[model samples]
Target chain A: MTVLDIQNLTVQFGGLKAVNGLNLQVQQGELRCLLGPNGAGKSTTLDLICGKTRATSGRILFDGADITNLAEYRRARHGIGRKFQVPSVFKELTVIENIEIARSRRPGLLAALTTFRTPLRGRVKEVLDRVALTDHIDSKAGNLSHGQTQWLEIAMLLAQDSKLILMDEPTAGMTIQETLKTAEIFNSLRGEHTIIVVEHDMQFVRQVAQRVTVMNQGSVLAEGTIAEIEADARVKAVYLGH
Target chain B: MNRTNHYDFLGYVAFAIIILLGVPFLLGFDGFELNTFARYLALAMVAMALALSWGTAGLLNLGQAATFGIGSYVMAMHLKLAASTGNPGGMPDFMGWTNVEALPWFWQPFQSLSVTLLAGLLLPAAVAGLMAIFMFRGRITGVFVAIITLAFMVALQLVFIEEQRFTGGQNGLTGLAPLELPGWTVDTYSLPFYYLVAGCLIVALLVGMLVVRSKVGLVLRAIREDAARLRYLGYDVAAYETFVFCLSAAIAGWAGMLYTLVLEFASPTYMSVSFSLAIVIWCAVGGRESLVWASVGAILVNLAEGRLSDMFVEGWLLILGLLFIFFVIFLPRGLYGLAVAAMDRLRRSPRTEPPVPVKEG
Candidate 1:
């Protein structure tokens, strides 16, 4: 059950290729780690898959449907979730409100006006409890701490019920304790949702990642477990530099 | 941040409604002379429209005046054309002044009030729909949107001026016929017109409240604070902007139609930047986020202008300008926001606003 399928996908920006001829597949309920050095198209691949940027060429299939022409929001409806490099949350909205907003999939103008929103509250509370943010549920999303915002974004993704999650540097700016807390949360969510994480921190990647893919120059350089990639001579020479 | 309110927000709204409803009798001794409050009431529709789009949704729409002008001029042209039928040669005074031969195809519909009313509603929406598609789709936000819409106002005014053959140029349209009700020929300046404007204002405010309390409103607030987050949340941020933009424009148009009947004139001045700024000032003075505050700001500011100009015509602009500047600088929340915050601070515990509480979640 391939949840996300990318074949020969490339992204270019006027004489610069950000992603090039990349082939990747993510299965349902798998925690896949995508590792790369700076400018290796890790985030760009996620961006392309999520329809943030157009693939210069190649196809993207999500849950057996070709979504190459879909807009970013349309892709969102198709069960693709993205957590940014920055912990982006609706600052003015409350915690419960933030998750509740992620719950509704109501379409059309009139339905949005007329639809009842009571059922979304239970799901919101459940996600908040999973993320351990129940106490801060009534607080504004903007006032949350840094690590908490990241977890809150994840909680929103959970509430959205997306089968595939794309995380870009979710632990970029966090303390060791916060990173471990995040890893615990990530590990707890492993079986129900398939996630593709683009991360720089190798220790965090090794904690919950089932398999890892190393990317450089917008395509996969290697694929293996964290231990396998860490011991690989090529990865050390090219990425870690001896 | 959620703050506890010492007094009831709904209770205050009810009190305000009581006062507003009682105004006819309160000022009955004066025989509704000029029916000044009715004019404010019509313009309050415009303010409420602005508050919904700008205050709650966080859209900076500088071109509200363009929409307002569209509605006003459309209604004015219709009224002028209707009254000019008896003067012979079949040419409006401004059209004749501009050396026109016949009424333009668009203006011909004014002959029937029914058609004019329809166009009065549709024309502004049509323009806003087209413009919003181009601008919001391009992800134009904040001050750029402001500049572009202000440009729209200036450009629209210029078009209205240059097309003097059609739009009456600078002198504008006048001498409108009284509105023909079911059985009464209601004078445009009479209490009937006042009540009409008041009714429209109330409708606009209620409609705005509906928008603010809808799922669309939730996403709009999200777009205002974090557009990218909303994008990832599977929301069409551009569509939200366009929807709100068109809504604001249409409401402004409705207000404009009423204004033409009340004031009995429409001029290029309706599209002026100063007029636009004055509306913004009204919103800023009353409080941008609260519907009641924005409308109150319009009435109070205009009423003050009436009295202040009578007392000191030379320095009123300075005073008004200073007042707006002072509020935006010191009390960014506007008067209502300040009052709410002040009252909240006075009380340590927050008010429970009913379970489910409209549940816009």
Candidate 2:
């Protein structure tokens, strides 16, 4: 059951092919890792999949539906959630309020106006508990520590019930302990949610990635299990300065 | 739900009591003073409206006066028509002076009080809705929104000034007949009219509070914090922005109508860029984050302006400018934020309690 299928996807930014003829497929419930150096087009590919950056030419089939031209919000509504490399939670709102917004079924103006906030309390609590942020539910997101902010963003994804989650550098600025905890959280989400993580940290990648996809200039250099990817001659050349 | 929010609620109740009861009775103000206060209250609505979009929805509408002017003109047109009932072809005096033979079709509907009332609010809302759709849909934000709105306001004021036969040009619609209700003819300086303005302010505050407390308000604040993030979270950021913009404009228009009643005319000056910026300054001074304080900012600023101008005469404008700069730099959150900080300090000084330990069980 392929949750995401990118076929010959290419995004050319003024003659520079940021993503050129990229093809990748992730099975439902698979925790896939995208490993690449800077400017390897890992982020660009995620942007294309989430409808943030329109592809120059390609077909993105998500859950077997062609969604290459959908709007970003519409794609999000269809269960494609993205966690930015930088924590981007609403800073002024409480953690609970942020989760409440993510969990909203109808995100329209009238629906928000008429709907009561009390009904989503149970679900919000559960999502917060999953991220180990239940104690800081009432704290403003701006007040959260860096690791806590990242976890809060993950909690938002959980509250959104996103079927396919795309995370970029999920453990970028975290202690080793926090990184391990995040990896454990990712492992716990396996089989219930399909996640694609773009990571630079090999240790974090080794802890969570079931399959590793190494990207070079603009396309996949290699794809296999962690053990196999580490042994690939081409991947070595790309990472070790060819 | 939090201590700060609890205190804010109580503060609003106290403010409401001051406006509804204290001003009218305990202040011992005469009819003239009361009418002046009524005018201040009317202007306060527009300030609060600006706070809703600028502070909550992250839309800096620098052309709020455009909507406010539309509201004032709509009410004034009806009053003009009412006053021209016995004139030739039932044409307003400005039209008569400009050599127009008959009333314009646009001015005809304003003959009915109910139609005029509805148009006062709905007209600004419709105009704002159109502008909001154009701007928000294009993903225009930040200072760009302010610039576009400011340009539109300048254009509107010019239109009012150029179209003399229709909008009375620079003079605007004047010598309006007092509003006639079912059995009573309301006088602007009378107690009933003052109460009418006060009552409208009260209603607007209540409605604003309801919105601030709702999930919509929460989402609006979220939009303000990061609209792109909200978009990726599956919300139509444009729709929410447009909703708040139109709503804020409608409230500004309502205030404009009340303003016409208090001042006895609708002038093109009401749509000026300076007037629009003054509304923003009022919101900033009162604290844009708090609705009650934003309104209070308008009243306080106007009251100070009245007194300072009388006392300083030549230097009042400079003093006001200095005051605004001081608030912008020293107290970014305005008086409301300062008061909240003071309250926090007061609470802390009484007891040096240890921080509560996080419960693991």
Candidate 2 chain A, poorest ten consecutive residues by summed lDDT: A114-123
Residues A1-242, candidate 2: write the lDDT tens digits.
99899999999999899999999999999999999889999999999998889999989999989999998998998898999988898888887888888885788778788765544357787878877888877777777877788888888888898899999999888888888888988999889999999998999999999999999888998999999999999988877888
Candidate 2 deviant stretches above 4 angstroms: A116-120, B27-29, B353-361
Which pairs clash in the backbone of model 1?
Answer: B4-B350
> Chain B TM-score in candidate 2, rounded to 2 decimals?
0.96
TM-scores, each model vs. reference:
0.92, 0.96
In model 2, pairs of residues that clash are none
* RMSD of candidate 2 to true structure, Å: 2.2
For model 2 the local lDDT of residue A205 reads 92
For model 1, the superposed segments whose C-alpha errors exceed 4 Å read: A116-120, A173-181, B1-12, B15-19, B96-99, B349-361
| lDDT tens per residue, model 1, A174-196 | 88887887899788777798989
iRMSD, all candidates: 6.9, 3.0
* DockQ values of all predictions: 0.44, 0.54
